[model samples]
Target: MEEQTIFHIINNMDKVTNNLIVQWNKVFEEDLGVSHILVLGHLKVHGKSRPSDIAKILGLTPPTLTYLSEKLVQKNLAKRLVDDSDRRIIHLGITDKGIEVVQRANQKGVELRKRLFEQLTKEERKQLLTIYEKLNKSL
Candidate 1:
């Protein structure tokens, strides 16, 4: 039998991972985009942060993240504000509405993850998780 290459495994995993993310996006009916949800979720987890910090954490550039932040602001989901001490610093924080969206989105995301992984046995889940962690660290 022929041995499958490492790239083959990575490609296959990327396909499934991306597809699952796409499907989860379909679960949202609100004005919240995936970036908005993720950004809000990060804010909720880490408290307030500068826009540049958020960009760094998410691996997004300033322009791209600025656009997302603007969209969230336009939708009343997030706010970009000046830093209290450093007026030049632009910070981001989720509004009550943003928190609500993150909560709902989190629920939906959890549901989809459960739907995808619940079918696998404990050992299979552990193996997939171990491999996924390794891949993430390798990247």
Candidate 2:
């Protein structure tokens, strides 16, 4: 609880996150970014969903979701479907290719985490996880 200690913790977290992003980008290799992967992952988990729902779940703006969806559709990773009963209702669904891509991305993510945390001992890793869980609960 000192102010300086809190600032140091915040700064370290930011640095760690930025480094993880860099590593993620290296492993991902595709043209898609993290948001695209998230959308695809959401669709894979939730099946077809409306753009508004996806936006809400992902904490993205409606316009941002629309843009990401457009890119995914263009890349054939996802498709937009109109509800049979309602012309105004549109749903976004992941394609077969999208599933494959998301699987590969997840595998790469696992590899990245393993590489990054390999230096930490099992006890240290457990402690870190516990600390993170505590911090998350507080948040």
lDDT of 1 by residue, 1-139 (tens): 1356867887898997897778878887886568777788888899878888898998889898889989988888888878888898878988998888889888988898899899899999999899889989999
Q: Distance (Å) between predicted and true CA of 75, model 1? A: 1.1
Tell me the deviation in Å of residue 61 in model 1.
Answer: 0.5
Clashes of each: 0, 0
- In TM-score terms, candidate 2 sits at 0.93
lDDT string, candidate 2, 12-127, tens digits: 98998888878899879888888899999999999999999999999999999999999999989999999999999999999999999999988888888888888899999999
Displacement of the residue 8 alpha carbon in candidate 2, Å: 1.0
- Backbone clashes in model 1, listed as residue pairs: none
Give the poorly placed runs of model 2, Cα more than 4 Å off.
136-139
Top model number, TM-score? 2
Which ten contiguous residues of candidate 1 have the minimum total lDDT?
1-10
Q: Look at candidate 1 and tell me the lDDT of residue 62.
A: 88
